[model samples]
Target: MSWKTVLNEIKSSDGVLEVVDARCPNEFRSKRLEELFNEWEKPFWIIINKVDIVPKAFADRSKKFLKENSDAVDVVHVSSKKFYGFWILRRSLKSYFRDNKAKLVVVGFPNVGKSSLINMLAQCTVVSTAPVPGHTKGKQWIRISSKLLLSDTPGVIPKEFASRDWAKILFPDDVEESAFILLEKIKNAEGSNFEELYGFSPEPSEETLERIALKFRFLKKGGEPDTNRAATKLLNDWNNCKLTAWWL
Candidate 1:
């Protein structure tokens, strides 16, 4: 769906839930979206999804940081895979809306587990979910409870992200360059375990891709390390949550 459509949906909703990846909460957040929510005068909350992979301390710190820095009413950390923090989220919503029913819109960048969270909350699969970016092609309104409704939208990037490297890294035209950028981010993040996850420490260089290619037996003609294939695999792993990293 287009950003204009998403904005229209948001305008129709009573509140907004901005789902973000717990592994890199700050990087995934959209300041422009927050500004829009504020301008619309809708209740806004930050849902930090995928807390199953990151440390609890990291999740807490992330929540605290967002609460301090953003305009969100509250920040909640949750693990959709492990079914954690659902009650708290529900309670927060209930307290805010009181006796009146509310229609909320869930928004976020691609592959941040919005659909999965919705499924977990509704206790069934109401929307399709996939590991890749832009898997949610359209919108669906789901009733999580008698008083609460949710609108699921396709992952969207705001206009401000057009110039950012991280945004380009999300839907990259060049996979190898994007992989290199992701590798550098992971290498620099605190508490990232490159060796534990991939069996070797990366050096933020093309040689790292070569090593990963050889290690995973991704080869091309004449037995050369297939850097493109290796980069694709690395990006896949990152998107699929097979690899985990967090920055503060």
Candidate 2:
């Protein structure tokens, strides 16, 4: 998202609730958004979402790292899907708006559960969900009650979002490259069995994908393995938390 769009959302909100993926802390955070919160003097609360996919220690360490790096108003770790740690965030918001109604703008990178959290808070599917990044478009100002309001906008991309950075929001053709990046991240992370997961060593080329195709029996006509199918499957598994050795 452009800075102007984010600015508009901030202008309309009383506070900011930023959601981030707990599995990949470094990749999900946006310094630009945090700077905006500080510049506007708005309370900045971070929700380290998808904590259920990773270990508890990952969230704890990530909370510490983020708190030390940024002057956020508060940081809470939770899983939006299963509603873990949702109570803490709910209580915090309720307390903040006890005497006055509060309107908060939800911001985050794509695929970080911004819409899902809104649904959880409203106890209904107020916003739609798409697994593909950059799928959410437009905005809505939802009224939960007299005490609170929520403004949901499209996920914001960080200033550092570019070729050098991992593509959080990917096009269809970008899936293979994104999957390769995801594999490398797991390979470099502590205690990850990236090689063992696919039953083959990692390589910059199609070696990992070829192995995956053979392992999963993803084949083309005449029994030739389909690497594209394998690649997509691997990516889907990683995204859905079916394939993750370690995360922090």
Candidate 3:
């Protein structure tokens, strides 16, 4: 779906839930969306999804940071897979609006678990889900409660990211380059366990890719390390949530 369609959905809803990955909430959260919410005079809550993957302390700190840094009505940490934090989320919305009926729209970048959160909220698979980005292709309204409705929108990046490397990394044309970018972020991010995840420290360099290739025995016909294949594996691990990192 287009940004114009997403904006229309936001304008029509009573509020918005900006879902983000708890592992790296800061990187995933969109300031442009928040600004748009503010401009529209719409109340928004930041839903930090996949909190099960991060330490409670980290999640708490992230929530605190977002609460202090953004204009969201509330910052909620949740694990849609574990069905965690939905009670608080529901209560927060009802408490804020002081009504039994509400219409909330869920919005976020690709692969941040927007669809999964809606499924958990609705207590079933109301929309298709996959680990890949852009799994949700359109908008759908789901009745999550007797008087509450939630609209699930296709994930979108801000228009400002049109020329950014992170945007390119999302639907990358070069897997090796994308892996390198992700590796650099992980290397610099707090609480990253390079040795624990890969059995060796990472340098965010070509040599690191070679090491990953050799360790995984991803070799070419001439027995050379297949860095491209190694890069693919690294990206797969990231998308599968096998790799973990968080930033304060």
Candidate 4:
């Protein structure tokens, strides 16, 4: 679903005190999910999952951004892989729902640990988690506590040019716009060096994009770089910040 649809649902839910974002640190920025949360007139918390997988640099930057944009918003870092920080997140939820008896919706992209975070919060395997994309295909509600109910929704890609808009939101007011652009450009330019550094030497004459796929081992059944599959793999990895330390 789009963030707009999610917001509309929250608005009509009759007093959801907090909106929880259960996305990886990089996705919270790349998809501009945090900006959507900050725009919310209602109180909310950012519950970032898969903390274990994200680099420390990204986590620190994300925390700083969360601290600055909205006082009502707090960032919660948790790793389902390591099962850490759920207690702190629960405390935040308890505080948000205190005396309000309101619902908290957990939203994020697919496979960003939304289901796992919800299951962990509910203290049961109430939600399903899988390694493949589009696992949580529908919405489910789980009660986190007596005063709080959490609604989990499937992941979505924004309909209109999500990537560029998201990049703008993520780098807002930093006064380093050109620097960010340059860095991204440099990363793409150094793709081959990265492959070699990782102990792989792809043919330079081959398609550069295909080289990326081959370097990452996203091969076809015929042991070739399936360009379509490579694109999908790269896009997913880029979204999840598996490409580089400063991937987001």
Candidate 5:
């Protein structure tokens, strides 16, 4: 699916469009989501979640870029980590709902923090939230109030979103890459560090994997962690995020 496809999906709906882009900064940037904003003739709001994980400098820059991208857009920073910006998002719901008090559809790439946002606003754990992708398979409609109806859909990867370069830059390509990044940064760490890094714990210890790769002679002659192969496996896993279990 192309970015245009997402736009078309929203346009096709009868309700007012409140395009919820739940993807992280990296995924958002890799797809050049801002370009979509520039291409859109209509105005939209951006509720960028996981802000606590993203640096303030980056967030500030993204806000500026988003604002400049569209006249009708407002970018808000949120981190479902602490349930920040939920009220701001609820208040921002006005621009789309208007006097019609119509249904508002929330759409974005899978695992982009949509369910968590909904749970916060509804004050009920009606929807599931996980770090892995492709968790939601069908349409799930949630009513926030008499005036507001929120609908959730399965994560759909746009056909035009085929840039591997973009993908790697945004999300960690796989568990290995995530593990390696976390491990390399560890002054002194454990499974919890890796768990927090990728949002999941591996069945085999990451260190065990590293040792196994070495035992199998997968390492380069240069004595590196064979991160290249490790990153490749991880990217594949991440790209096909449906294989992973949802965070329950």
Candidate 6:
């Protein structure tokens, strides 16, 4: 279902569950959702999930950035995979709805751990989950606690432009440039060796597609680097969280 429709129907929603992938906080920012939340006067708590793979420094910065820039009542870093930080989240939720059960609608970009949050909060596997994006196709009501009801909706990703938009996505022709841009971000954030993560070193203006092609043995006629294939593989690796220490 479209987010517009959901937001319209839930104008009376007690709150919004704004889930975001902590590893790719910049990429997951949703201007549209923020606008809707503000328009509808719906209070939100930004849940920065998937904290296990990230350094605490990164997680702390992400939470601070989100809290400072947004009108969120609260922001908490969580890792459903490692069973971390849910106790604080649970306490916050319970405190928020001390007198009445609040009906909250969970929304976020694809694969941000919405279902996993529901499962963790309920302390059972009440919603289906997958490692892939768009795994939860529709909406379901999940009881997180006696005083909290969550409406888990499909993960709605912003429409990916075929061009570079952070790690959001890349246009086919812009794939190599996108890789360089993302690598630059990693350099600034983690300062990890790009070669260690991607299996090849990148030279200034040296094509990432070529490096990936040679490293992965992706070749075309005359043993030429299969650039298109290589570019797609590189992006897929990024999409699947394979090519970076700080991958989302």
lDDT (10s digit) by residue, model 2, range 116-136: 777766564343332323434
List residue ranges in candidate 4 displaced over 4 A: 1-5, 14-40, 109-112, 123-140, 154-157, 164-207, 210-229, 236-244
Prediction 1 global C-alpha lDDT: 0.81
Which pairs in model 3 have colliding backbones?
none
Q: How should the candidates be ordered by lDDT, best one leading?
A: 1, 3, 2, 6, 4, 5
What TM-score do all the candidates reach, one by one? 0.88, 0.80, 0.88, 0.59, 0.53, 0.76
Report the Cα lDDT for candidate 3: 0.80
- Score each candidate by Cα lDDT: 0.81, 0.70, 0.80, 0.51, 0.49, 0.66
Clash pairs for candidate 1: none
lDDT of 1 by residue, 158-242 (tens): 6356436666566777889989888888888877657886788867788988999999999998999999988898888888888
Residue ranges of candidate 2 with Cα displaced over 4 Å: 1-3, 95-98, 124-146, 152-155, 158-163, 172-174, 191-205, 245-248
Clashes of 6: 2
Clash counts per candidate, in order, are: 0, 1, 0, 0, 6, 2
Off by over 4 Å in 1: 124-140, 158-163
* RMSD in Å for model 6: 5.4
Candidate 4's residue-wise lDDT over 147-198, tens digit each? 5556655344343433453444233333234223323443543232335333
Clashing residue pairs, backbone N/CA/C < 3 A, model 6: 162-171, 163-171
Among these predicted structures, which one has the highest lDDT? 1
lDDT of 5 by residue, 148-167 (tens): 55555423445346355334
lDDT of 6 by residue, 1-101 (tens): 67566665457578887787777675576767778778887877888887776678888887888889888888888877777777787677777778786
Q: Model 3 Cα displacement at 101 (Å)?
A: 2.6
Shift in Å, residue 38, candidate 5: 8.7
